[model samples]
Target: MTQRHDIRLGADIGGTFTDIALDVRGRLFSTKVLTDYAAPEQAILDGIDIVIRDAGIAPGDIGIVIHGTTLATNALIERRGAKTALVTTEGFRDVIEMRTENRFEQYDLDLVLPRPLIPREDRFAVRGRIDAQGRELQPLDEAALEVLADVIAERGFGAVAIGFIHSYMNPAHEQRARDILAGRLSIPISISAEVSPQMREFERFNTVCANAYVRPQMADYLSRLQVRLKEMGAGCPVFMIHSGGGLISVETASEFPVRLVESGPAGGAIFAADIARRFGLERVVSYDMGGTTAKICLIEDYQPHTARTFEVARTYRFCKGSGMPISIPVIEMIEIGAGGGSIAWVDAMGRIQAGPESAASEPGPACYQRGGERPAITDADLVLGKLDPDNFAGGKIRLSLDNAGAAIARDVGDRLALSPEAAAFGIVEVVDENMANAARVHAVENGKNISENTMIAFGGAAPLHAARLCEKLGVERCLVPQGAGVGSAIGFLKAPFGYEALASKIMGLSKFDAGTVNAMLDDLKATAEGFVRAGTDGAIVREITAFMRYAGQGWEIPVTLPDRAFAAADTAMFETAFKQRYARFFGRAVEGPEIEFVTWSVKAQDVRPEGERFVLETDGAAVAVPARRGVFDPASGTVLETAIVPRDTLCPGARVAGPAVIVERETSTVVTSPFDAVIQVDGTILLVRKGR
Candidate 1:
């Protein structure tokens, strides 16, 4: 069992599937397994066994393992995490509960805000105060903290979160409180300053509480995964991908599990960004449709858009401000509960509605014949003849068309007074429109046109619906990359060892001090670099950003700063940058309002080699069709004979006309009647609109 440094493994545990990808030098081997809820790690192990066997490599030969999961997010959403207590400043005990007091749904008088993670009884307040200028306003009551620690110990709380007023500016009080609690309690303790150091008490407090809520569960899961992997002969160091689309040591992940909330989806964005870079596409709409959820992200200039804060478990139609805010660096994306297993049912309004709930992997879709009585999106896809009944998941799990048809007929067809095929078509159309509307909203929010961007579709279910999605969005081209089924797992292998550190220090342009700003930025840079160094000693790249806003404004926009030391003369440059960015965001900038810098961020990452350029082939010879099948065409509103081509047999420069199914082991790409498919030099399937 000789070690092979070139052998790296990447695993992503989604809600419905655990995808494993093995990279043997430049070659890739991948597989997907049904997620085991009771023992999630078991699915990863099973997937690993499959890929390693296919790659002809032993577990001991693996050099490194990169893993991502949705466990932390699910815990918060399901309220299944450990019992947690919140310790905050006396008057600010209700910060998380109070939220920002903004109405996400203004017209609904009965709207109920999401309950805080820590119940009111579990929240304790102490005597402490830190001013906005990082100055101590009141001394922390050490005795109060010691007494609270004893109370926490006696109550058997699994985790504790401490978030004092203005802790982001001065963390001395919060640190002291955590030290007192750690000495008395054996449970994990989290401080808001370390979890989310930016301003805004509501978001910061909620972030730390969320971290503490899931700390015990995530730590236990990650520990068990490592132990199991070691038992199976994989002794390589394991790293977890964070929500920022970077690899961090498992130790860091355990301490800051909140950062891993969007880890799996971040990988998908990174995969699409890499594909965009290779193909030289400047603006790409990254569409990832897995079994339980679908995510859409905007990638521009060969990088996925990033944000300093994002919400989790949106409860109101995935509306902004309707979920728990996590103030951590993350890749920005819009996620909807529209996936293969998303449940579809007729609403009270007699309209077909897809999910914010899913069957997940346990029962899966009705077509899986796993005791799921309800019809799901997968059942609709099956009933519509988009999926092959005999060869799903490479035939490892046989699909039952009878089961699918029966479920749809019982639930939707009978209720809607339509045949199963028609009902299935209606269901698919509803879900697709849901996704398309989401994409449209996301692009408009970002001030971009959806039709102007090329789409890069991945995940098992994305390609099956991508062609139709393109038609709806008026997108001219879509790229279904190689190994699309396990795109996120493959993304983990491509991610760099990186970290982002954020801090808050209010500074007005009129009173700007270059020395103070430089010192703060230097501290942040060192902190980010230290985290990156834990994983690699390679050359590092640094990026700096300033969150800026006009005086008396409630929100700010990010302005990227030059990656160099600033001087007193640079104040005007900073003002100019903010003005330009502000104009771009709002179409105009106010000249009289004084500008201020609210927050600063530093991101550091180890450099990696760039991928080779991909040349798309437009003119190619038609490929031989292995078979033909009766597939439903939405454009024609009828089932038509379509060519089915084996993906493995199609070489570079191969082309297939519209109404074709490019079949592969992991997933299939359905080229609709309006588009034609061409095999690129890198084995990517390019779907272009007819006469484009």
Candidate 2:
């Protein structure tokens, strides 16, 4: 038999599962394994073994490997990274601790801010100064840095971060300090200029500190993964998906692991955007509900929204300013603690609440019966008949119904004075409402109406709850694409080799220096292209963006720029573009204050083949029901005999009226009584309102 070399593999390590997707040519084979938190890579190897065996192929036949993980994000949230120190310009050591000095919850008298990653005692100061115009005002205090290095070595610090005032405008001071420290300490060092060159001292300093904090752990894990894959005879080039929905070489990912903070969720957004493009849907809302959390992203014109900064681990009810801010190119989205393994309990107010805490894969939900006693969303789902005990994960792990009921009854039912089934219903409703409210807030913040967009739901648990969520949000349509269980892993196969580089240079449109602007943009373009060229020699496409705001504004909005040389005559064009974008964002543009460009971004990517168009069939024969089971219907508030149909048995255009459960190996789609399901030509399940 001939061996094939066109095989690609994508692996995603979430909090509760390690999902693997293998693409041989165009065919996909996927599986989900319980996450081995102690040794995450071991789960990946185990999953790879299963898919390759089923595909009748050897590990050597794989051509490339793409991986995304939440390890960096988890390390930050769990505070499990190495002991790290921060070095900043003298008198500015408390910038991260002070934050922006704004209250996230202004009315709360007992509000407490999230602690900085590096403590005040661990932060040291050195005398150095740089002006706002890329000029050094004072030389770096090398003597002070040398003395600090000795203190750091004595204290046994594992990593160091250096952030100097105005480092984004001039990096010489910060760079010089790093050289001095690197000469004495044998530890990882991160500088703000290289990590995040945008303005704003607090955000830039925090970002570099985060990068250094997670550097050692991420580097070690990536190295071990490479060695293990090689030992398994899969000598393919390993790449990593970043938070910006692009692929980068492993070497780059290791150097800047902060870019991988939201990598996993970014892939899910890319998956939904790709589907929207194929279906010609201009507006979309992507819903991804995995084991530990659920992510919601808004897509416009077939592209997911992008942002320059995002907060991590929001400590105050997922509020914007309540978490550590990391300034990097990222896909903007809102994530809530609503997922399969999220815990459910009664709060101080005597109301049932779903979690910001998860049971994870260690013990998982009560139904897994590993040792968990707390009731989780998954346990409630099982009690409500949304999950099949004998068929979960293709029967690899059997669920215990008795254990689920006991746990729910003990944790929630007794307190609420409700039956076990009633308690289960309450848990499910709370989580579903949480997700729906998040979607509504996300849309309103973006000046969009939630009901006008089609929902594209994925992940292992999204399909099971999407119909009810749609009903809550007034959405009329939802699409559950094939391979929805391992959506992020499959998205890795679709991401392009790309990178975005940013630099801050404030310039008023009236004083636009065509020569200076051209030179600055050219430098940024080269830097971005260099990152992409490391992975591919294919044709490259470049995009330019200028972050502009009226003079004296604290923040700016992005304006697209043509990828061409600029001249003084184009100043008016810049003004006009800013006004148009401003009006689109805020309803009207102000004619007064002069507009100034604050930051410039250039993105380079390898061109990918266009996806084929998807056409839906409006009419089809009803699919056969192989069996029927009593499932709880939230709308009717009673148990109904629902049709249980295997997904593989449904042909394209086959229709099934609710209430029905379309079961597949990785997940299940629950069509509520108010909605009907139809299989599209590409095997995507389309759920629409009963009369729509």
Candidate 3:
């Protein structure tokens, strides 16, 4: 039996900063470092060393490491990945190019669609046919595959993605193609049936192609990182957080790299959900504003919203159907390119716009003084007196106010004929409104109300803007939890060792087959449990979901089923569940319409970690502040004097009236004039509307 060590590690690699947290016997130690564009692993190693030193422990004391990164996402967006090829069914060469054929920008005549990840030149088609119902028509041609392998090897392709039509129903053809290709080609092969085995051909194909495109790169990186960690004397096994907020072994992650695309943001969602559960809040909005992007996820009943499919790298930031669709289980959220490093500038239409682009870490915000000339959100925050120049990043990196002022003045102030102070204020308000709108849209789409939810904010920049975001959305309360700066890393530490397996097998309640359903579910449960066993020797929990829909409906909704074996009588239970979920989404269910099941999912995990529950109450006392500073307020369009309070000095139930700044090591909280800040029982800063 393996021993459970007291020390564990969690690392989150954001676009601008790589956050690391070490949980030693429940006490946390964390640090933030600039992301190394050339070598991401080097940054992690460096930060790990620093954090271990700070915790006064040796590297060998750590038992496990859980990591989450945006590398796959950034690679897809920036078009940086290994040379990849696609092998598809004959006569379907243009399916990826002619995506769903929907115009995201319908009104614009000259709309630009995003370029497909696999170019036509690299895509190869094979002569094989599998009918939609698992029937074999034309067998896979090995001769054609052999020739294609020769051509692929000649072209020096690093990876190959095999996605035959209807492979999800019968993976025999795809598996045969992989075996044949392996004999002649020395490269990684990704099949749609294994990566994303759902029904939609376009989505399954695209997802497998993406996985192959980044397989070699991610595998090499993970291998090198593990080797380096062992050399440094920390030889503990490392796990990765998947996009669905579950931990998988690094080997599994390397094979299914696409699952890691939104992994970092998923950790943030898990963190918010954990906070919501601790506070006993039912409805909450997770606000994670980091260096490169801001992610907003809605949580109800301590669960983050999940979706079977999500888009990646949207070409039009505000438009749907403008990006590559990947078929997988993921935590659903709205991620916009608005963060502390989001560049601000005047657009050609004589209007100011904050990013859907970012400065990242290399030439971060102008306030960092690292050769950045473009004005960014951090620069605006500095100009607005929201950040302490000398105490930024726990005084590790001093900010340059002059650089921020010059950059903003040259880029935005000159264009608008306004001072840099006014431009900075405009930048902040615009970004805040952008985040607010994203939250609103996400909530509305999910059939939820944003104003009725409490905002749980975290990340390096979330605390700074969370209160204002709540104010814009008409929210009553917002909580900046303990260690908000490295919240995602902390989230990783709290994640359960788990895996989910999905199978697409069409079935209907009218002709329910209990034996077949039980067999399929049993297989999925075994597969999921096998993965979870890699991390622990403990009792595990299982959950199953069935994707169901009315007959002739294009989309399906998830209806959770009991973990036990399905019996003949359970058909009525399934029907009732389907009807209830359908009513919740569409407001009504037709009595005569036939309902069919599309897919099945099984998730197994070690029991979730529990936290000590506590109640938050107010003591009705005020903490005295020592000094004040001039801060910019867009509500009044002028600078005002604001109190500066140290975060550690505040006791439970102590309150401070805004405008005020709560300063901490990793981040700062900006309490707007209309809100008052109070310290909760768990050292969480709760900001509330003045009259609420």
Over 4 Å off in model 2, which ranges?
1-5
Stretches > 4 Å off in candidate 1: 1-5
Candidate 1 worst ten-residue window by lDDT: 1-10
Full-model lDDT for every candidate: 0.92, 0.93, 0.91
Backbone clashes in model 3, listed as residue pairs: none
For candidate 1, lDDT tens digit of each residue in 1-692? 12234889999999898999999999999999999999999999999999999988899989999999999999999999999999999998888888999999999999989998989999999998999998998999999989998899889899999998888899999999988888888999999999999899999999999999999999999999999999999999999999999989899999999999999999999999999999899999999999999999999999998998998888886589999999999999999999899998998988988897899998999999899989999899888888898999999888999998999989899998999999999999999999999999999999999999999999999999999999999999999999999999999999999999999999899999889988989999999998898888879999899999999999999999899988888988998999999999999889898999999999999898898997766667888788999899998999999999988899998989989988887889999999999999999999998888
**For candidate 3, lDDT tens digit of each residue in 196-225?**
988988899999999999899899999999
Q: Residue 478 of candidate 2: its Cα lDDT?
A: 95
Q: Poorest 10 consecutive residues of model 2 by lDDT?
A: 1-10
All models, RMSD in angstroms:
1.5, 1.8, 1.1
Better of 1 and 3 by lDDT: 1
Q: How do the candidates rank by lDDT, highest first? A: 2, 1, 3
